[model samples]
Target: MKILDANDKELMTVRKIERDGNTLVIRGKIFGAMPMVARLTPKEARAALKLLDFKTFFFLLTLLFRKG
Candidate 1:
């Protein structure tokens, strides 16, 4: 998954996603910035999903629609 700014400039990229026991590990790098990795439990992931802003959701939806 790619994270973009309002101008559609790449801000970050989700390079890898994996399951670690009951947790989800995400690896990525911010464009022109340092790398980052995060581990989230199922509950944390759910909570993060619930916190997604409308614009981000719309961006993702648009990307999906474009692929189809």
Candidate 2:
């Protein structure tokens, strides 16, 4: 799955989208080999990055668990 920006630019390739508490967590492979951290917004997830840790968690999981 792919995430596109407002202009339709590819932001990240997603593996899964999960909800944690009042936040939405996105798990995916990013920038080739880097672990990316991005948190979901309370209202609009795409608006800001409030929680960085959640993003890191998802990133690691996707990196380690993604099947070849």
Candidate 3:
């Protein structure tokens, strides 16, 4: 999904996610040019989870495990 700023400007688009050990690796692009990789530690992941609702959280889990 595409992440946008307050003015609807494109930020970075998340392409895929993978879990490596205790961190969540996010692979995507920045401004649709430079490749970007972000690793979320367990503590950071928990902090981000706080912004998501119960339904959204479950939905994401399903998507993560869904067969392509």
Best model number under TM-score: 3
Off by over 4 Å in 1: 49-68
| Candidate 2 vs candidate 3, lDDT winner | 3
Stretch of 10 with least lDDT, candidate 1 = 59-68
lDDT of 3 by residue, 1-68 (tens): 88888998889999999999999899999888999999999998789989999999889989977885
lDDT of 2 by residue, 1-68 (tens): 77677997777788778887888787786744555656676777543444557878678678867774
Q: lDDT: which candidate is best?
A: 3
Stretches of model 3 off by over 4 angstroms after superposition: 47-68
Ranking by TM-score: 3, 1, 2
lDDT of each: 0.87, 0.70, 0.91
Clashes of each: 0, 1, 0
For candidate 1, lDDT tens digit of each residue in 1-68? 88889999999899999998999888999894779998999888789889889998788788856853
How large an RMSD does model 1 have?
3.9
